[model samples]
Target: MTDDLIGKQIGGYAILGLIGRGGMAAVYRAHQVSMNRSVAVKVLPRQFIDDLTYMQRFNREVQIAAQLEHRSIVPVHDYGESDGQPYIVMRYMAGGSVDDMLNAGPLRLDQIVQICAQIAPALDYAHGKSVLHRDLKPSNILLDDIGDAYLTDFGIARILGEAPGSTITTDGAVGTPSYMSPEQAQGHPLDHRTDIYALGVSLFEMATARRPFEGDTPYGVAVMHVTTPPPSPRLYNESIPVSVEQVILKALNKRREDRYDSAAALAAALRTAVEAPQASPPPDPQPSAPPPIEIQPLAERPIPAPVYPAPSAPSLRQVPPASVPKRKRRPFRLNLWVGAMIGGVLGCALLTVVVGIGLLIVGTSTSEVGPGETPTATADVTPSAHARALVNETAAAVESATPRTPTRRATAITNTPVERSGPSGTVIFFAQRPITVDGAPVEAYNLYSL
Candidate 1:
C-alpha cells in the first residue's frame, strides 16, 4: 500500500514520497494541491480501514491532534478519507525525531535540559485540555532544523472526561513498554502524571544514552518499570548534575502521587537545576613533611690535672738545672691534653657523617630495587616511542579503572531560541518564524490559535 501511494494522489493531495511507517499508519510527504503547500500525511493502511478498533484510534488521533494548537505541537492541517484509506495532514518537520539524535550519542546536558523544557510546557498544555499522551518516547518527539522540539504521535492518547472504555486498549496495557509508568504498566486508570513518567524516561535516555530499565521482552520491561528502581543518571554519565538527577527521579516516582504535580512543576525544576551551580569534589589530602631535628652545643671540657712522671724521669736520667727551675711540665701537658681532646671530637664527627651517608644510600637503593631483591645498579634505558606510548596508555587505563569521585559542571543555558508562552488569547512569533515540516512557508493554516 505504501509503494502504491508514493506517487498517487489521495484526497486532492499528491504523495511526494514516503516518510516512514509505524505500527498503524505510514507517514508520507505530500503536496496539498488545494492549499498548494507541502505537508506530512499519515495514512492508515487499506487493511485497517475495516478494522473497527484501528479506525476508532485513527479518528481519535485526528480529533485530538487537530485541536492542539501550540508552538511545540505539530499542527494538523486536514483529515480525510480517500479510496477507503484514512490520512491526516500535519505540518512536516525536517529535523527528524529525538530518536535520531539519540542514535548518534547521548545528548549534552544543556541540550537535554532545553529539550525537556520545551516538552514539559507542551505536556502541561495538553493536560490542561484534558489530553493524556500515553505513549511519550524519544521517537514521538520531532525536532526542527534549529533544534526546537515538538511532541507528536497521540495515537494512544486518552481523553479525560470522555466515556469510559471509549478508547482502544490492548490487553489493558496500551503504552510502549519501556517508557510506561508504573501505573500504566499495571493497566490502571491514568492521568497526566503518566505522561510525566514517560517524559522522565525520555530524559533519562537523553542524558544517559540508555533507558533506566531493560528486559528480554516487552512484558519483562513493563514489569521492571513497575518493580525496579531507576538507576541514577550519574551512574551512566558521571557529569550529570545532582539536581538534574533529582528532577528525573521525582518525575519517575513509582507512585504517581510522588511524582511532579504537573509538567509545569517539572519544567520549573529542570530550569532551576540547569541554572544551579555544580558542587565540586573535595581535593585529595597531601602527605606531611618530617619535623626539624635540633642539635645541642658541646659542653666545655674540664682541664686535666698535670701528671707527675717520677718513674719516667728516673729512666731518662736527664735532670734539669736548678736555675732552669724545671719549667713545670704542667703547661705543656695541659696543651697536649687539649689537642688530644679536639682530635677525638673531630674523629667522632667524621664517623657520624660516614654512617649517615651509608644509610642514605642503602635506603635509596632498597626503594629502587623494591622488596626481596639484592640492590644492583640498573642501566638507564631509553624507551622506544611505541613502548612509551604503551606505558602511557596502560597507566591511563589503570587510572581510569581506579574509580574517583565524579565531578559535575554547571551547565549554562545557551541563548537558544525557545518558545515559552503557554496557550493564551494572543499569539506572538519569536525569533525565526515557524516553518513547514519540509522547511517551506506554511500557508493557509493558522499554526497557532489564541
Candidate 2:
C-alpha cells in the first residue's frame, strides 16, 4: 500500500505510522483495536499489488513466516487481504534492526556474536522447515528492546520441494547483492547453505562495518561473490580472535560445500569458538648443547649396607650455648687543635658582636657623656668633609710649590681652611678637639658632637 493506508484503519487495527517500505511491501506500525496492543503490520506495496507473481510470493511468505515459532523469529499473528492488498501482521520490535546499529560503526566481537547467535537459531529452524531465506542481512534481523534477535522478511524465500524454475520472479537477481551467496550470485539453484553464506556476510559486515565485496555497481559486487575471497574480519578489527575469523571465513566460502551444512552447524561452531578455551601455539624448537650429566665409576663407589639405629635410644633435651656478648667500642678521639680553632673562631665572633653592641650603646646613650660639660678643643681635631677637601687641595698646592725638590719629604701640621660656594646655603661648623685616650694611639678622628 502507498502512504494513504498509513492513517487508515483495517480490521480493528489502527494504522499509526509507516515504519519502513521496500520493493515488494511496506511495514507499518499499527495499534490492535481489539486488544489495544501495538504491532507492526507489513502490507504489500501498491505497485506490487497487481503483480500476480509478487502477490503469490507475499502470500507464501506470510504462510511460511507464520510457521516459524522460534523466539528469535518474529511471530506472525495474522494475515489477510483487505482492499485487494495482502498484509502480514507481526509482533513489533522496539529496538529496531541490526542495520540501524551498523549505520554508525562496527560492533564489538561479543556483541556481533551475541546478535548472530540469536539469529542463527531462527535461520536453523526455518531451514529445517525447508524454507530458504534469500535475503539474510543486517536489515532483515530485528533486535527487540530485551536484546533478542528476530529474523524477518521471508517474502523472497524459496520454499523447498517446489520446482526450481517456479520461483515468483526468475528474470532478475532475487536478494540483496552485498549479502548474496555464491550460488545466488550465479543464479543457480540455492539450498540452506545459501542462507548460511548470507548470514556469514551479515556477520562479516557487523564485525567490519562494511560488506565483504563492495563495488560501485551491483553487477561488480556479484562478480566478486563468484570470484574473490573476502578479507579476514580481523584485518578491520584486531579485537576479533583468529577462531572467530576462521568461523566467519568458513561460512563465507564461495562454494556451498565449503560453507557450513546448515545455520545450526555454523551457530554451533561460533558458540564453540566463543566458549572454547583459547590455547597458545607451540613454541619453536631451539638448537643447543645437551646438559652435562655426572657419572660415578662402579668400581670406585662402594655400596653401603643398610644399618638401623637402636630403637631403645631416647633423645635428651639439650640447652643451647649462651650467645656471646657484643663488645663496646671506644668513643672517637676529639682533635685538640680542631677544638682550639673552633673555640678561637667562636671567641672572635663573640668579641665582634660585643664590640658592635658596645658601639651601638655608646652612640645611643645621652647620659654616658656629660651634656653640660663641653669637651675642650684641641689641635688634633676630627677631620670634616670640608677640611678633607682643603687637605687635598693643600697637598696639590704643596706638590706644585716644591716642584724642584722631588726627593725631599715634607711633614706639616696646620689647619687647612676651606671655602665653598653653594646654592644660597651658609657653611658653619662647631669645632671640637680630639682628646687622647689611655690605650688608643693619637690620631685624627671624626667627632659627631661638632
Candidate 3:
C-alpha cells in the first residue's frame, strides 16, 4: 500500500520515495507542486487507517506540530486527507535524522554540542508553552544540510494543560525503554524531566557509541532504567572530561527533581563543562631529582709530577764519548828530610874517594934529596889507615855489586848448529868448589868441557 503511493498525488504534492518508517507514521520524500519545493510527507499506514486510536493520534500530530514555530523545530507546512488516509507535510530536512547519524557512527563532541544547543532550547521553549514532548528520542530529531538540528515528531506529545496526571498510554509505556526515565518506566506521573532523561541517554550514545544499559527485552532495559544507577560516561569514553561526566550524571539522576531544572539548564551546564578550561595539575609531594653530574674518566686526567725529581725536567750535565774515558794524573811529592839525607850520603862517599886518591899520590911521592939524580917517583903501593879503610869499603861495595854465576845453567847456543838443538844439546854445565884460604869459600865457577 505504501509502494502504490509512489508517483501518486497527495494534497498537491507528488510522492517521490519512502524516506523511513516508524511506529507513528511512514515519512516520504515529496515535492509540493504549488510551491515548487521539496517537503517530507508523513502518512498513516493502510493497516491503521480504520483504527480510531491511531487515526486520532495522527490528527493530533498535525494539529500540534503546526502550532510550534521556532528555529530548531520542524515547521509543519500543510496537512490533509487523501482517500481516507491522513498525511502531514513538513519542511524536508536534507541531512536526515540523528538516528541515521547514530547508525553510521558515534557523533563528534562539537557536532553533539552544536546540535544540543539548538534542540535543547527548542525543548525548553516547548515546555514553556505547556507542551511536553513525551516521546523525545534520537529518531525524532532531524538535521539540515548545514548541520542545524530541528526537533520533529510531536506525535505522542501532550498539551500538559489538557492532562497533567494521566498516563500517555492507557495500555502500556509510551517512550523508548532505553531513554525512558525512572518514573516513566514505573508508570508514574512525568514532567519535563522525562525529556531531560532521554536527552541524557542520547548524549550517552553520542559519546560512548552505545546505550548505558542494554538487555534482551525492552522491559528488562526499562527495569534497569528505573532500578539501576547510570554507569559513568567515562567508563565507555575515557577521553570524556570528569566535569562533562558529572554533568551527564546530574542530568540522568533517577529522581526528576535531582536533575536540571530545565532542558536549557542541562544544555548550559553541558556547554560550560565542555568549554571550561582544564585545571592545573596538583604539585608533586617531593621535589624533583637533581640533574646527574658527569665524572671525568681516569684516562683523561693529567698525571701529577714526581715528588723527588720531576719526570718532565731535562738533565743539566753533558754526556761523554762512547770510547774509554781518560783518568787524571796526580803530581808527585817528595819529603824535604829524605832529600837531605840522600845528599849527605853522596857527599860522604865523594869525600872518601878523594882522600883515598890523595893519600896514594903522597905515598907515591919521591924525596928530592939528590937533585942530580933523576927524580924517580918510587911509590909504595900501601895506603895509610884512613886510605886503607876507604879502599876496603870500596872493595866490599864492589864485591857485593857483582852477580854470582851458578852451576847447571842452561845456555842457548846460537853460535853453530852443531846438533841442531836450539835450546838443549848445545848447553854447558859448570860446577865450582871454592878453595878456602883457611876460612870462607869464594864465589866462582870452574868450567868443565863436555
Candidate 4:
C-alpha cells in the first residue's frame, strides 16, 4: 500500500506523514482531534495482516507491552484495528535511541555506565515479572531529553509460566543476530541471564564503538558470536579500566552458569567498577633492532714463484706455524660440566617421582574418608539446618539484588509516519520545526526529526 495519507483521519485521529518504518510496521505521528493531543501510532503493514503468523506476533507485541507500565518502557495507550490494519498507540518519546549515540564511536566510560544504570532496571523489572526480552539491543533502547534510558519493542519478549522452554520454542530465532546471545542464536530456551548477555553485548559495543562480531552476512556474524571470544575493549580505548573489563567478560561468558546470575549482579559489578580505582594503561613494548651478521675470512693462498719476495715471506710464515703446531697444548681440565648437568637432571627426575607418590597416597586417603573428615578448631562448620538457611538467604539476596531503572517522562508524542535513525538520534515529533501544542492545523504537517 502507498503511504499517501498526508491528511487522512482514522478513529478521529489525523495522520500527517510517515515517521519511521521497520521490517514489521511503521510508526506515524498523528494528532488526536478529539483530545487535541499528539501520539505515536505503530501499525502493522497491510500486506502481512493476512498472514496469521506475522499478525499473531504483531498482536503479541501490543498485548505484552500494554500490560506492563514502567517509565523505561514506552506506555501503550491503545490497541485496535483501523481499515484492516492493526495498530498500537504508544507514548511518543522525543529524546531518541541509544543506537544513535553509539554511531558516533566509543562512548566514554561514564556515559556507558550511566546508560547501563538506566536500562538495567528495566531489564530487572521485566525479569521479575517473568518476561524475557529476547531482543535487547541499543536500537530498542530510547533516551529521553533528561538522558534517562527506556527500553522499547517487546515484540519478542516471552512471558514465563506458559510452558516448559516457552521462551525459545514459542518463536524460533527472532532477534537481530549481532546482539543475540549464544543460546538465543542457537534457538535454545532462555532465562533472565540471556537478557544479561545481550545487555553485555550492547555495553561492549557502546564502549568499543563496534559490535563484538561482524562479517559479510548476518549468518557469518552469528557464527562469530557463537565461536569467537570478544576482542578486548581496551584495544579500542585504553581508558577502559580492568574492573570494567572483568564485569563485561563475566556477563559475556559463553555459558550461562559463568555469566552474572542476574541483572542486579551485573549492575552492582558495573557500579563497583565505576567506583573502583582506575588502572593505568600498560606500557607499550619497545621495538628491537635486527641482529648483526657474522663474517668469515677466505682461506689463505700461497703466492706464485713469479713474486720472489712474496714466496720468501710465505716460507717463513709456514715455518713459524709448523713449530707452534708441534707443541700442541694439553687440556687444562676434562669437560666435567657436562657430567654435572646430567647429574642435576637425574636428581630432578628422582625428586619428581617421590612427590608424585606422596600426592597419590594423599588423594587415596582423602577419597576413603568420603567427606567425613573431622575439622579441627581451626575449621568452622555449620550444621545442615544452618547451611540450608544460609543457602536460602543467599538465593533471596540474589533475587533482591537485581538492578532496575526508574521511569522518565517524554516531551512530545508522534503518531504520523517517521524516519527512525539509530535509537539515540534526535527525534522530531512533527514534520516541521517548532511542534505546535494547540494542535497545528490538520493540513499544516510537520516532519519529526529523530
> How far is 82's C-alpha from truth in model 1 (Å)?
1.3
lDDT of 4 by residue, 111-133 (tens): 88888887888888888888888
**Candidates, ranked, TM-score:** 1, 3, 2, 4
Clashing pairs in 3: none
Q: Determine which window of 10 residues in candidate 3 has minimal summed lDDT.
A: 417-426
The whole-model lDDT of each prediction reads 0.75, 0.73, 0.73, 0.70
Q: What value does the lDDT take at residue 378 in candidate 4?
A: 18
Q: For residues 321-344, what per-residue lDDT tens digits would candidate 2 score against the true structure? A: 999998987544335565456446
Model 2 misplacement above 4 A: 169-173, 275-450
List of clashing residue pairs for candidate 1: 92-437, 93-437
TM-score of every prediction relative to native: 0.60, 0.60, 0.60, 0.59
Cα displacement (angstroms), candidate 3, residue 172, comes to 4.9
Candidate 1 segments whose C-alpha is farther than 4 A from its true place: 169-171, 278-450
Which candidate do you rate higher for TM-score, 2 or 4? 2
CA error at residue 407 for candidate 3, angstroms: 81
RMSD of 1: 50.8
lDDT of 2: 0.73
How much is the lDDT of residue 238 in candidate 1? 91
Which sequence of candidate numbers ranks them by lDDT, best first? 1, 3, 2, 4
